[model samples]
Target: MQALYDVPAPAKLNLFLHVVGKRPDGYHLLQSIFTLIDWADTLHFERRGDGRLARHDGADAMAELPEDDLCLRAARLLRTESGDAALGANIHLEKRLPAGAGMGGGSSDAASTLLALNRLWGLNWPLARLLPLGLKLGADVPFFLGGRNAFVEGIGEILHPVDLPAQTYFVLKPPTSIATQEIFSSPLLARSKSVAIVAGFPAHNSSDDKNESLQSTGAEVVKLDAQGVAKLCGGFGSNDLQKPAEAICPEVRQALQLLEARYGNSRMTGSGSAVFARVSSEEKDGMSNQSMATMLQDLPGAWTGKICRGLDRHPLSGWA
Candidate 1:
């Protein structure tokens, strides 16, 4: 049987997330910048002739996942869409990242599965061909598959690649898992009525780099104006869902405070629970794991924290 081993599913930090509007289908239209981080989960796949999809969980992943988790859904979706009935695999997941932290862990796993299995099964599908299947799994999945730090829009399907500087981050996952639906359903979500983008969003495609608006601060991130629109200068936009998430989960607030107290600034990544603070860039030699450990020593045993550097692209970016 052909197999793929030790495949990585890297996590993502949404530099900022903005809800621009609500679609007629009740889906919230969103704009965000997604950057990959070093922290990740691992997946392994073994090809099987028996046309049966199975999952074997490795230790350390949080609570029992649903029967139809995103991994299986991605596989099943790919198989069903491929017009091939006999393709199947036994998937092994060594999940280290915390779920429901809005870190895009599971979606990354699913995207990696599609990329790895496409190779293991010799389907040789391109990134474009696999992206639609990915979007069926989740909005975040396509960003991982796109394989770059991007300014994302259109309910998360439209991706505009951006040039981002390298930086270090300390991500904290408080002992709480937030329900994404709950946060989105909250009446307090800060969906902006009008959205203004930076100079170059997409005149046509990612290749149009003539007038891209990117301003830099010290180890800076992309920021937006108070009206919920991206600005041409420094600072990133807000994770609009953070307010609702904090209201629902007090741990979100606690985690934000802890990181802010130490790093001088902290913001919830995607939705809730996991908040991150910019550490130092590699030019500064980066933050040491030992120092991170020392700072986290007094925190509750249930909480999980990590010192991660940003990745230029997905590990399997070249696979498809």
Candidate 2:
């Protein structure tokens, strides 16, 4: 195919992020459930035989996108890795997701670029081949390439696919942005002991034996179905970075308070300023688009909000 149009790069929400430890290299080890949501940025790609790669801003594009955008990085990396200097693409990105919101927007876009270009160039490289290349771009890139809800660990490279229940979430993005480096480098950030999870989350304070925690949780973990996954939503675990992120961007705190008051449970996703709340599927079903619109009417004029649903798989799951 010479062209791919309107390809999707979906965003992700961290159900819960816990800093388990730090590597000798200073990279933090973490455990979290990275769940895909319907909110996405769109990309269009056209193969260029002349071997010239270019990027364009689509509707609502972010202002001042860096010259070395992830899409370009991904394309160049793929070309270099595949040894196909003749391969090139013109990529147009529709930047819907807010940067620095901990939504994995850029990483997702990069992953999508790799997937689309592989097919365009007839590389037909399997996901395993693409994964290492993706890792070089960013920690979260592999998760998007894996294309499923996953239990992620080890600076976001390790992924174990988990079936997540279908559910809707109210995702709110404050005007302010929080840098991931800032949160990770903060002296005040909490590095918690790894929390164990089975089919369900145990009480937050449980102190079970580490070996037993893994063994007992292992069987039940594999057996967890959609209903089981749904129960864990808004109930288990917490974001370790939330406090630090809120301190850095007060709007994060304000957004969380607003959602928590209405939705009972809300937390910052990934490392920053965007927060999400679990909304009942039934409640969402009963409401019209206009009703959903009014739900966020009270949000600050500078902020943006969306009612998004969790996806079992990324839209490009089978492409690799």
Candidate 3:
């Protein structure tokens, strides 16, 4: 029996997202650096002769996503594109990350499926071919396929490889999930800032190169060495959707405030209800097992949390 087991679909955080403008199609123009994290959902696939796609875990039994799952769709798309009928696999997802926390769980899952099936089916589709299909899955899906750190832009499809500092983070998800589209459409959303682009990474938060309208009022400069980068992920980086998300979900606001109080540099990831803090690498060694336990114990009765390390690369490509 040809089988592949324990493939990783890693989560990601947008270190910072700047909305340059909106396109004619109503998609927002964005510029951000995305880094993969070690926190992941695992998939196990066993080739089946019967050609049926099955998911044994991860998704809720009543969650209604199995029928519309990107994982299954990815497999189907690959099969159709390659014109192969003898390929099939039984997928078992070991879901660890929370859904809709803006952690890219589903997109990661879909990308992993595309990769695993490409190998298992022996079709040998190049990453470029797999990418357009993955875009059909999610904007974030293609980044995982790129398999390296990137400066992403243009509704999250265009990608440019970047050399990003490696780091670890403590990501905390509140009890609620914020819908991505709703956050984008909020009337309270700040969208009038002049679209500005910096030539290179600024010194964590000097904002000297940023336009006045695009600068955060509370921004602070931070120094991140390799070790410091591994621990505390630079300074208090900002996300465009955070304010709107917080305005709609008080739980998200509370999560950010609490993490900031303890960790100093805290912010929400993606279109979040999840907030994270930059812990110094030295501090990370001290907490390895104890910090998560301590933080969870202290968390409000209504939240879910985890300690996620920043990755200089996506997890799946380590397989390639």
Instruction: List CA RMSD, all candidates.
Output: 5.7, 3.9, 5.6
Instruction: Give TM-scores for every candidate, taking all chains together and pairing residue i with residue i.
Output: 0.86, 0.89, 0.84
Candidate 1 per-residue C-alpha lDDT over 162-223 given as tens digits, one digit per residue, 9 for 90 to 100: 55656677899998898999998899887653453455454322323342344432212333
Q: lDDT tens string, model 2, 85-153?
A: 989888899899998899999999999999999999999999999999899999999999998987787
Error of 2 at 10 (Å): 0.2
Clashing pairs in model 1, backbone N/Cα/C closer than 3 A: 222-235, 222-236, 223-235, 223-236
Scored by TM-score, the top model is 2
Task: Evaluate residue 70 in candidate 2 and report its C-alpha lDDT on the 0 to 100 scale.
Answer: 96
The deviation in Å at residue 94 for candidate 1 is 0.2
Q: Sorted on lDDT, highest at the top, how do the candidates line up?
A: 2, 1, 3
Candidate ranking under TM-score, highest first, comes to 2, 1, 3
- The reply for model 3, stretches above 4 Å from the true place, is 58-66, 196-237, 285-288, 318-320
Worst 10 residues of 1 by lDDT: 225-234
- Which number leads on lDDT? 2
Error of 1 at 161 (Å): 0.9
